[model samples]
Each structure stands twice: as structure tokens, then as C-alpha cells.
Target: MNDHDRTASEVAHSLSRRQALKVAGGSALAFAAGRVVPSGADAQTPPSQPADPMQIILPETGITLPTDEVTFRWVDSGDSKALFFRAYFDAFTQAHPNIKFDYLGLPWTEIAQVVPLGVRNGNAPDVFQVPQEIPIAEAVREGWVRPIDDLIPNFPAWQAGFPPVSFVEGVNVFNGRVYTFPRSTSRRAGIVNYFNRAYLEEAGYNPAETPLTWDTLRDAARKVTENGQGQYYGIILVGKQVGRWEQYVRNMGRLAGSSAGPDDIDYRTGEYVYTSDGYLAAIELLLALRDDGVVFPGSMSLNDPQARAQMPQGVAGMIFEGEFTLPIWVRDNPDFEFGVSPIPTPSASFTPMGYQNTGTNHQWLYAESKLPEVAAEIFTYLGSEAGQLAFVSITGGSDPSVFDSVNQRAPVDERMRTVYGIYEKYMRLCPDVRIKNPETSQVYLRLQRPTPSFGEIVQGIYTGQLEDPKQAMQDLQDRQDQALDEAIEAARRDGANVSRDDYVFPNWDPTTDYLESDYAELG
Candidate 1:
């Protein structure tokens, strides 16, 4: 049904409930009072309740403002494992005596469907958390939210804290303006290859010092497989979606060539190097592994969480994962000896491009809100060192450097340090073009389809769905062109000034390397 119709129906339901309650209790109340209460007057007036005070607190900085009371409506994603939202509310309320938080938690699955409805209904929260990947530009283009740049000055620093080539760009910016702040980040890297030292020794190989190349990895997999027989597999690949395939593709790229600099941009030319030969070579390598029987059965359907749980159980020796899996690793396999290293390249000549998988800052204000200044104040507080630290501490993540001093004693992890190193050295701040306008963002998503008919030609060769790679590639290119044309046309119809030149495809070639040799060199 249309939005208006749905809204009318909901209103009718609410009115019906109110009418039923009155009918059930009014007669008894009138008899007890010994008088007949006027129907219209009683119906028009409802008992008033005292307003709750707004409470605000900065957890990391230990700043408390309990006197300022405000009720915050938030989506309650049903995942019990995700305590970030609830923890944030509790921490804020406990610290601020004047500020009281009214939380409205909705199921995770309903979040996307409900958020827009909230905004339209004037029931939107002062602060809301969203996944880094949700399209924010669409919200802005429709005037569903306001630009937050004027409200938060430290936004640039928050944006710079992430690895530039990562998905942060897709999360924060919309139509040249920032809209949402990131809370976490993720990276797609090759499997964390672990070998059974005993098995490797029996196979006449030194597991600790083995070269971390695709060929060496495969060789080790073969040896490990001999020991497994029918009980265990030599390797496990969580190949459930394009996300899994991305890690394999990245690893293969390292073998084929080096990555283009993360800071490098050619928005006007749409000349991303990710489409280069190196990237294709990487895809080919992954396909080769799939064909070699090194990967476990049912790999294409297995997700990352299942793969992670299986590792400590000894179901597989290697698994590809992001940094968030560290906590689980420590919990399930405390005594399990493992080593952490950057994913390896094909050769010494190649430099692997790592993915930065974390959240970012790109909050926005509501231009049409009745409490614009108050909303701005809330957003400003969020960007403040005190505000950001509180968010980080509660969520078990790091805050932006601009807010670092707020939580001086917070524990640091090796993975975070490594991520920071990458951010400082090779990463660049991602442009906010995608979210600059809803139409453009929609076009970009359409262009990123993972099927051959939709411009993802490499899918055919990797999945063995096509015999002729060259023909498939050509077909994919044709599909991409058609999609781009359609996108451009749609944008024009929506009055958006988009063109082929506006797109920024990633470049994954070695010839353009310009990042400093090491993270230390970045300074």
C-alpha cells in the first residue's frame, strides 16, 4: 500500500484502541463519581504527565550532564550480541542527572523500514546509529535529514581516521555533505592461514616460516589435507556472498600486481584502477584455488561467523576474517596458538591493498526540525572528544583522534594499532560524493551489481558459470555501459547533474603506488 494509506490505517488502529479503552472503563468511573461525564469534553482531554528531564553524559571523558533531560528514540536491533545501543543509553543516562533518555528499540530487521517512517512522522530520535553501508545520500536528497557540517567542526578529523579506500566513503557522505557518524569499520582480506605445526613438520615443512603466497598456501593446504582424510578439511572458505569473494579477490591482486594509492582520486575521469589487470589476475587466482580442491565443501554457502566458530573447533586450519573476530578468538581458543600478519602478496614486487573495515563520523542535523539549535547541540556533543569517547568506550571500539584524549586510559588492541598504522601510511580520506545526492548514490549501487548481466563480468569465470572468459568479460562491460546509461538517464529525470565523468572506480594497479613505504614514514 502507499505510504499515505498505510499511515491512515495506522492512525485508525490507534484511534480504535483508544475508543475501546474509554468504552470499557468510562461507565464504571461515571457511576463511582455519581454524575455523567460529558462525552466530547472527556474525549478531548487526556490526563497530563510530567515531562522527563533530558540526561546527557560523555562516557570516555567522564563528563556528566544529568540535568539536561531529553528522550531519545532508537531502533532496537534484536541481536542480543549487539549491546552497543543499549550500553550507550545506559551510560548516557547514568552520567547525566538532568538528562533522561527514552529509548524506543525496534527489531533489527525493521530498522531500515522504520527509520524513514520515524523521520516522516516527527518521531525521529536526536541521535541514531546506522550501518556504515546504508545509503545516506538518498535520505538527504529527499530532504529527510539535514547537513551536519555546520553543527560539528571536528568532523574532518573523524573522517580522516579511517582507511581511505575502505567502505567509509559509502557510509558517511551524501551530496557533498556529511549525514551520519560511523561507529565501526570492516576490512576484506585473505584468510588468516593457520597451519598445524605438527602436521607441517610431518610433511617436511616449517609452518612458522612458510612463505605467505598463494602457491605456498596451496602447497601447505595439500599437506594439511592428507592428515584430515575424512574428518577435517585442510581449509575453510566462507564464500557466502560477494563480501567473501572480495577477500579472495584482494589476495589474488597482491599476487598479480600492487594496489593503487588510496588517496588517489580521478572523479572527473572515472578512472579507478581496480578494473586493471592486477585485479582480474587476483580473481583468476581465487578461481584456481576453488578448482584445486583446497577449499572445503559447501564453502560457497558458508558465512563468516560459522567459519570463525569452526576454526577454534579445529574444523579448518585457515579462515578469512575481519578484526571484530578477535574477541571470539580469545574467548573460544584462549590456548590456541596463532599468529597475526598482513595478508601476503604474490611476490616481493607486489604490495597488497588492505581493506579498512570500521565505522566513521558523518552525522547530520535536521534543517526542518523545530529544535534545530538543540539538535545541533546534541550533534556537536557527539563530535566532541567527550561525546565520541563515550560512544567508543561503550561500543568497545576506538574514538576519532580528535576525541582521543577523552579516553586516555582506554585499552588498545593490536588490530586497532595495525589499522591505525594503515590509516596513517597508505590510506586517504574517502570523498563524500556518493552521498552527495540520493540519485547518484542509487546509481553507484546499481553499478556495483555482482552478476555478469549487471556488469560484474568476472563473476562468470570465478564461479565457472561461463567457459569463455574473454566473451564473458566483454558481455559484462556491455552490461555496465547499459547500466551506466540508465543511471545517467534516471538522474537527469530527477534533476540531478550526473554524468559518466562523475563516477570514481577504484584503481588496483602497481605502477601508481605513491604511499610511503611504511606507517612510520607517514608522519
Candidate 2:
């Protein structure tokens, strides 16, 4: 079969089959030019400049248009920082006079609260970034979203342009149909160590050139804290933002040997490894520093924004945060000098793992959208090579594209380049259970998390609320194990052919990406 036929077959086998896509008049050449003739423009008028500033990759072709003027609302947690939204949206409107946007660019914290409210009130944006609070699976199961295969023109050709795991089953594909794409690279996950260059210099260390070992990091925090003399501390964490604790543990846990995906379960053994040596050590290090009073004193009360804001003001010397911190600091506080490095591990030599899954987080096309075709076109644009380049250029490379080619081609500043280098040299992809067994994703959606959660457990332990850290971790593992068994049973009740074995990957390695060919061992 041809490439187009093969891609269509792959999409059909993904989650579920959908109606064949419909295409209207626009052509590849039309999208390549990123311009619109404006339904009634005079043939005499010269075409406008390219919609994509970089004008590299072709946008979507053969998109159908509405006869009357229409406005669609859009919301994303990253929009303000992404900046490309304004330019791309305006350019899209310029091409189609009848199309307009009612855009809402809010902080992720707010999006978390707003999304559920909007969905319940039937006012959710036509297109929106999936909130962290709701699992994408739950949204799909409840009919909050629809598959994009029927909306994006040329169902097969458009998706062919992305990388392998860009549209994995169970993550973005439900029942052999596509949903959304996670365009950001996992190599630049937020579990990173960002520091104040001035403070590190004062402590007689340069982390940018040589990353810190676990022990050295603790010592550095102590030194910086001591030198501050109550003026500034060595490190600050978002204790109030409970998720930060879990984020740190999971990302750094691999170094110690958690070897599982972010869910804290090691797929090799099909067991939750929260109490594993690596994960425990990561937690202990933070507690040890907090006990030594090296961590910022006011950390317990600070949220993400508050904590991140203090780093540049010299409230503390360091923060365990993600790539988002880069562009904001540069734009808002130009004078503050900072640097980012991978989160330190127990030993100087260590490995970090990243996983891809639809159940993770993604932007979705709402089921309630009256203009599904138009909404799909917007995401289609963002997912394009040219659109990705424009994003990199406008966002200052703070968030690199999923496609390596785009990251390489787009112009970036020194710090963004440094981040890309760090992700490339250090991060490794772990086994994705969803790829092996899409039904396993059903178990995840049904699984119930234990009380206090991962982050709260960390806070309770450090604040002297939860007494035994090891036991607490063990209890969490046990609770999750029970929940997994129950969820599996529930999935089976719904006619899903899945079992606990689906989560295990005997042939998996902690140091390398789990390839499609590796699934052969399961048989």
C-alpha cells in the first residue's frame, strides 16, 4: 500500500474507526503560502505576506469554511507565554474574514479551576488546553471531546509529519481515532534545577559547566543558606503547591532507580515503586535540607508563582522547577542572572527517563464546538513545522517543539539552546505501557489515588504531620496496588481485554527508549 493508505490504516487501528475526512477547495500550495484571498477579494489585489513569520512548513490544506461570520473562543494555560497564538490567530482571521477568535490566555493555575467550571456550565472554550485536574481519558469517556481525524483535512498526510509517539494510542487516540497532540518535547520536562548564578558564584561553584551531585547539591544549599544569614536562603520549594513535591520525586526518582514512568510504577515489574531506593532517596534529600534550615523559611506558604518570583529577587539561591521559568524571567526581570541544569541525583553518574501518553496532558477539541473544522485547523497550524518554528521564535525557545527538525531549524537564544542541549544529552525515554496495551489506560482512568497524595505526603512528613516517611511511602504503594487491581477489574467489566501483565515489560531497560519492536517479548 502507499504511505497515505498505511497512515489511514494505522489511524483506523489506533482507538476506534471514524468517518472519512471531508476536504473543501484550498490546496497545499494555498496553505504553503499561509494566505487567504478573503472570500470576495478582488483578483487585482496582491496576496498578503505569509501568515507564518518563518514561513517554512505548509499549514493545513483543503479546510472547509462557513458562509457567515463566526467567532470561536480559545483558552490555553500556555498562550500568554506562547505569544505565537496572537500572531497565528490574527493571521488566520486575515485569511478567512468570517473567522474570529475570543481568546483567553490565563495562568495554568487559573485554567485548572476554570476548565471544570466551564465544562459543567456548558461554556468551555471551543478549543482548550486540558487541565491537570482532569484526566484526558475521563474527558473522552464522558463525551467532553471528539476525535480530530474527521476535522483535520487529509486525515493521513497531516499526521504523517509528526514523530513516532506524537499520536500514541491511549494517550491521544481513543478507539483507533486521533484526539490531540502533545507537541512539547519530553526531554525538557519541568523536573530540573534552576539556580541563581550570583548565589552559586558566591558559594564558589559553577553548576552550568558541571552539574551537581546529590551530596554536593545539599552542601551547596547549606553554604548558600549560611552565607545569607537570614537575608536569603539556599533553596525554595513550592510546598503550598503540593504537585511540585511529586514532580520533583518522580523525575529525579529515576536516577536512584524508580525506573518507572511519572506515575511512579516501574513497568518492568508491573509494580508501583514509590518506596524504591531511588524515590526514597530523592525524598530524603529534600527533607534533610529542610531540616537543616537551608530551604527557604517561607516555602511552606508559597505557591508556584510566589516561589518562582522569589528566585530572581534573591529570596533563595535555587529552585527545583521546569523550562517555563526561562522566558518569564527574561521578559519580566531582565536584570536577574540565572542558569538551569538537570535535577541532581544520588550519584554524579545517573540516568533520567521520560514517557509519552495521552492520559498525561494535552489540548483538546471540545465536543461542544460548533465549528469543529475551524478549531482543528487552529491546532493543525500550531502542529505544523512552520507554526512550530514561529512558536520557538516568539517564545524564545523556552518550550521546544516535539519534532527535532523544528527545534534544530528554529532560531533560539543562548539559554534556550542550553536547555535543548541538556535535554538531548541527559534525558532518555522510558517504556510506555499505553503503547503496549491501550486498554491499560482504562485502568489508570478508573484507579483511585490514596489520600494526602504524593505531594501532601511529602509536606506532611517534612512538617512533622506524617510520622514515618518509609511506611507512608510503602502504604502509598500498597494503596495504589489495590487500586490498580480494582481498576483492572472495572475495565474488564466494560469488555476491555486487559490484565496486570499488560503493565509489565520484562524486556525493558531503564537507560533506553522502549521501542515498538520490544513488545515482541510480551508474547
The best candidate in terms of lDDT? 2
User: Per-residue lDDT tens digits of candidate 2, residues 1-523?
Assistant: 1111222223212211111121123532211112323322423432222333343232435687676999988887552233445445655765777988776665556677777788888878888877654566778877888888887777688788877777876678877888887667666566578899988889987888878888889888988988899999989998776677777787778776678776677877889888998888888887888888898988888766678878888989889876766766765567889988777877878765656422223678888888987877776776666666666655556677776776777655578688777766666676777878777767766766567577778778878888888999988888878878998999999888999888888887878766667776666
lDDT of 1 at 208: 40
How well does candidate 1 score on lDDT at residue 154?
57
Top TM-score model: 2
Tens-digit lDDT string for candidate 1 (52-97): 1011232222222234455544333322112233433443443444
Residue 246 lDDT, candidate 1, scale 0-100: 44
Model 1 misplacement above 4 A: 1-86, 93-171, 175-177, 182-211, 258-269, 272-275, 352-382, 386-410, 415-474, 485-523
Local distance difference test, each candidate: 0.45, 0.70
User: Where is the poorest 10-residue window by lDDT in model 2?
Assistant: 15-24
Distance from true position, residue 312, model 1, in Å?
Answer: 1.1
